[model samples]
Target: MAHLRDDSRGQLLLVAGLALALVFIGLALVVNSAIFTENLASRGETAGSSGALAARAATEANAGTAIEQANHYNPSAPVDAFNRSLRNVSTQTEALSATSGTLSNVTYAGHRNGKRVSGAIDRTNNSYTVADSVERVSGANGTRGLVFNASDLPGESTPLVVKVNDTTATGDRNSWRAQIWETTSDVHVKTFRNGTSASENRTERCSVPSSTANRIEVTAGLVNGQPCDALRRNDSGANFWFGNGAGDEYDVHFKNTNYTTGDFEMVVYSGGGPSILLTTLSDDAIYDAEVQFVYDGPDVWYNTSVRVAPGEPDA
Candidate 1:
């Protein structure tokens, strides 16, 4: 009877040990699976964040392009034309995001109205105003979309000078000026801004070969179709696209326009201005736009509002 009891006890001990071993193995598997799942979720979320940001950038860029194109197409009915163009842009961007396994959408929220002034750069002996009493878009900080196309520009002595004068500026020291001239081989863009005093004055110059391109996109900060350092940023690290230091409200004027033969254009953010030498007719245009952007992906969701203003100062 004692031997039988001992044998039974040994068998029970073996069974208990086997059950504990199996339990430990099962628990280990469950813990490892949990850790792996958590890691996967973290990685997925990181990727999703990147995708969302990329989508946002694409949407904004496309919207800006669409706005410019729309203005060119239907300047008479600016807002309606921009809406139609924006819809097409949104649809294309959405499809593009899907290819990367992300979902995205862009919708136009609204726009600001402005005037598009364009005409010849051919004035006679004296400087003249292209647009007077021009102001930035209501509530906006600056102007945008100033461009010039010219050839056979004269020398610095009687150059084609463009000025943005602060309506309230007391003297030339407060106005911003751009002097366009040509060397034998290159076209030059020189910028001047005498902030408040002579010591605060700043000037910069950039040049491109005359044979390259005839376009100088002032607000866009390009010369001969290439980026120009002088028009982009001033010595103080402030953007001087059209002219810094001049108040947001200013007058656009041309000096020695005969020195350069070309066409010029700009979008004055103000409601409307009296027709001047350069502009015979001012077209209604969309100056800027607002849009909503949305993105969704594995473990991530993003939504934001973006303002699209092409060639905007410091944009």
Candidate 2:
């Protein structure tokens, strides 16, 4: 009986030892994950900043070439030439950076913008589609709307904001006006042409919900006009499939139909700027970019998006 009791005590001690060992192991794993996550965030920021700066450099260096090529462009036209030029610049920059300090597995997404002036690159085709964005116009006609690529906006959510400043008018335009709406399909837009009732001077704003459709349509008219009802998904003209409702890749557009004599700037934002462009992806237009970084140790990846416009710089 004494011997049996001793064995039972040994068994309990062994079980306790195993439990302690497991606790230590679990602690080590948690620490490792925390460290890796921190590394990813910090390194991702570095790669993103560097990449954005380099992209800016490349864009500046290649703008003239792109324009020169576009002057007589045909076939794939200037877009093909433009992309090639950007790729060349990105490749050179990547090589230089990697050798100097940038991360590896750093893909030179010299990925083509597919002639898109401003948009996010599709993972499927590697093309750009600008979404959840805003644009401003310096000078304009009675009708003009900036088009953004589509994204999946969460249902009944207003993750996007459109702000227009048409009040800065002079001469033949004393009355400032603005109108914003969305569309799901490519049909005739009537909000910003000939005669729209923006005769009163004011600033206009609206929140864009992800529900009701896949596209943001615009005509230049009343802020709450019948055409604007498309926001409700009740409009037969609206193609609700405009967005997938997945909470990514949602497109936002802005329209101005009454600013014919003065200057105006329309800002579309989910609440941010930079890492993007307005009309073209050249020179001063190369506003921001998304930099992808991969770390092999522990197998980690980080994608850092940076906008250089508001002064994000390396430390």
Candidate 3:
């Protein structure tokens, strides 16, 4: 009876010890799991912050590229290139983050002279769109603004407008006007015919009176019946002839014009002592003008500004 009692007591002790060992193992596993979960959460937050910074950097780089392209002879191509570059940067940054299981959102925002320019992107679904809300502040030349939300991830869209401004104009005329000539060869020259003979003549080449060099041709001859011929003339000679008569007045008109090359300029002042011309990419018409992007930020909480300096030609 004593031996049986002793054996039963030993069995109970062994069972209790086994239970305690199992319990300890379970507790250790739980603690290790908690630590792993905490580490993962911290990594995710770090990724989000890094992603935002990368996206913002890409956005600003794109804006700067677009602005520099605006100074190019063929702006459309460069502008297109600029957009592609931005997208590429976005993709790369997203890929970098996506390796860690995070998605990316890239966008564009544009502004000029410190004013908010309207911008948007339409997704393939056609039911949704992302829009940029821009704001401006005072700058060296004038008011300048930063662009935001210029692009959307998971969708491709074009800029609503390209930002351009004239820094100079040269002419006796104080008022500056922008013109869009359809063809590269549309520049017009006026030939004066002798009153009595067809042989006597002086050829005057007339171009759109703006600081920029591209000539713009339109169907209409004048604005509000006010003749541009009177206001526009080459400083060296009288290039434009004004009058309803066929020979007395020559109207420069462009037919079947191709603005695809994107060679154009922004005339800063209309009638003034000297005109400053801001060069831009090629565009079809003055109506196709757009604002360029300069800056972008995240958190929707910080105030930012952009500075535009005249780009000079390479020596």
Where is model 1 more than 4 Å wrong at Cα?
Answer: 1-46, 137-140, 234-239, 271-279
- Encode model 2's per-residue lDDT on 16-109: one tens digit a residue: 9999999999999999999999998888777566554554544443443443344224324544554565466556655664664554333223
Stretches off by above 4 angstroms in model 3 are 1-51, 76-85, 111-274, 277-315
Across 246-304, the per-residue lDDT of candidate 1 in tens digits comes to 77677777888767777777776655443444446567777788999989876699989
lDDT of 3 by residue, 1-315 (tens): 245588888999999999999999999999999999989877765655655555455555554554445434333354455455546655665576466555554433332221111222222222221111111112121111111121111101221112111222122111112222222323222322122233432233333322223222211223222333422343564432221112211111111112112222221211112211111211311111122222222312222332222211010
The global Cα lDDT (0 to 1) of model 1 is 0.77
lDDT measured at residue 291 in model 1 versus the true structure, 0 to 100: 97
lDDT of 2 at 24: 100
| Decreasing lDDT order of the candidates | 1, 2, 3
TM-score of each: 0.79, 0.26, 0.25
Give the better candidate number (1 or 3) by lDDT.
1
Question: Which candidate number would show the highest TM-score if scored against the true structure?
Answer: 1
Instruction: Indicate which candidate wins on lDDT.
Output: 1
